[model samples]
Target: MLVPSKIQTMFAAFYVCLVFWCLDSAAGAELAPPRNVTMVTLNTQYTLCWDWDHTGNVTFTTQHIARYKLNSKKKSPIWSTVCKDILDRSCDLTLLNLYYLGIHVLRVRASVNGRHSDWVQKEFSPDKDAALGPPTNVILTPAGSDLEVTIFDPLSSNNSSMKELIPTLAYHIMYWERSVDSQASQTHQTLTSSINIVILPNLKPWTWYCVIVQSRYDYYNKGSNFTSPHCMQTEGATPWWEIFLYFLGSLVTCFLVMFPSVYSSFWCYKTLKATLFPSHQLPMHFKEFFGTSPGSDVPCLLTPESESELLCDNVTVRLEPAILEVHDLPPENLPAPLLGLKPGSSAQHSRHDSSSSGDSGVYSTGGRSNSQQPNTSQPIAGVIDCWNGLDAEQVKMQEMALVLNSRPKIPADEGIVDMCV
Candidate 1:
């Protein structure tokens, strides 16, 4: 119903009224500046905090903003925002550009609907206000008779608070023997960089020790609180007496293990030697009677019957033929004449005996019949032909061979011997 220009002018006046109402509302709702601004170091991070007045009846929708500037006089101070839209009362300083050993000014304020409160400012030095944090990843281990400790600096990272402030770090180590009424010992070591590991030497062996570590900034002269106490034990040194006993036990064990083999080898060697090179000496009485001369003759005693005549008068005849029974003969005894006969001759004699046994009244060389004629014209020798060219050892061996071959084998159940022809 209104004209176009009138309508346009009315809309513009309404817009201006709305704008002024917004400005007045914003001015009335402006937030109060934060108070008691403080900076504190926690672990490896720096935090800024301030107190807010929540006691007023007026309700305000507010947010906090933090900014920092370097405390340099010549350089144009350009403030850098640390954090924005912060509903909490604290802001982390790790997000800011920190300068080492340089002064800084930090400001924080509250904002409500684009209207800002007065900024609360504080001056601080990175070195003076910076606090070192406790060492992390602390470990203790035994190093022979000593103790080895390893730790990592909390401020060694790029985002740490004290990294720029502290040029060098020093460690204070406190240790004591874990016993009643024992005094504690302290050691100090300054390192240009992070101390990754350290060794405490000259410690008591096989002893328990309690230890604690703390770190300090060289420029700030502030030290962190001591870490949790750690307990460790050093390895024991082996005693000389125990080492000697161990050696002796080893030697005894080796001897016990090798003794059986050594003894068995010695016995085997002795047996082989005896078999290969046996003693060849006769008895004392026989030694005197048997001469060593090559051609010397020795009289041998013989057994004969009354009808038997000795061709040599120097030979003695102590045994009677009746006393020399076949059963009484030695197991090694063989026919005396067969020793000089060849295999062919012996076989021929055997065939002749088999063919003319009744008429010839003879037998094989192994034995003779009673009707066989004796060779009285033949001279009796002391030793038989079987032993003529052989030594005593050879003769013994030959006798053993014959005995083994001709020996009678008895059955397990039968006691009587079975003589083999």
Candidate 2:
């Protein structure tokens, strides 16, 4: 049992030394130098950034000294620690109040657990290293064949106003007619800083034009990309040929719209006049009876027959057997379309047909070709008599029923109706 206990103690000592070696190796690997030290400048601001390999929390330290100070052999190179123990990999050094156009060297190192890595260094100049950005959301308006363009400045990655931070920022605008090739188009440019608007004068009216704008900082020699082309049509006075075309189109449209209405109203008026007041000549004998004697100067007021008289137009219907014969023929035997039908074959077959053909209730669409409809002859006798004694008998019957007051009336076969009054 004593030998077994001694072996166990020796094994515990070996395990402790192995753990110490591993911890030391891990510490050495973690304290490696930061990679890719870079200096970035935007306008008057300066930033120092670096890349690191390890994960988890880390702190960085940044130092900068003027390039001229490094070249002086007599002066001691003093690198002030502008950023100390920062969690972020990038550091903003604008607060240090360094000269913007002056060249400077920047260095960064990683720190964890009181251990430091070797410094990684880079050189930067605010005048040459800064990047420029383009204007955004360009707008164009037409001022009577002239175009007015408005430019708005761009924003930084954090959406802050980058133009306000840049004092020397200016804009360059170019415009040309759309009909010409962009490479060969007539264009002009001028630097504008105070105002965001520019005008292009004397463009052709009703013509299209394109515009593009870019921002630049002349002092820093930084220029951004140009914006996308914005094309718009210009407005101006009207041309004579165009006005004539518009007038012609309006005249044709109005005629097409009003023609149907005019024709329909005229047709309605003619039809109504013919139906309400049929035109017929007075009989010659009747005209002579009502006329004054050729030599007399007396008015008809003293005439005996004109004093009290009931005047009515006498009409005589002269329906022929040939018309009846023509009406009774079958549709197939009538005729083909647009050709006249002369009926003679069915004349002797039926006399009963002539008797009933005058009634309106017996009307039919037959007696015409299958390929076409039969024409309805105008100046129709039936339509002329429609408002005459057509409904007189029925109206008289209604009046008689009203007088009876629901009492039973004598049948027509009795030849008499007793009066209530």
Best by TM-score: 1
Candidate 1 structure lDDT: 0.61
Clashes of each: 0, 0
**Regions of model 2 farther than 4 Å from truth:** 1-30, 73-75, 136-141, 150-198, 217-221, 228-232, 238-421
Q: How far is candidate 2 from the true structure (C-alpha RMSD, Å)?
A: 29.8
Q: Give lDDT per model, in order.
A: 0.61, 0.66
Question: Across residues 321-346, which tens digit of lDDT does each residue of candidate 1 receive?
Answer: 12111121343555453356443222
Instruction: Give candidate 1's error at residue 293 in angstroms.
Output: 57
| lDDT, residue 31, candidate 2 | 77
Candidate no. 2 TM-score: 0.40
lDDT of 1 at 227: 87
| Predicted structure 2: lDDT | 0.66
After TM-score superposition, what is the CA distance of residue 3 in candidate 2 from its true location, in Å? 25
TM-score of each: 0.42, 0.40
For 141-185, candidate 2 gives per-residue lDDT tens digits of 998888888888776544666566676678887777776655674
Error of 2 at 250 (Å): 25
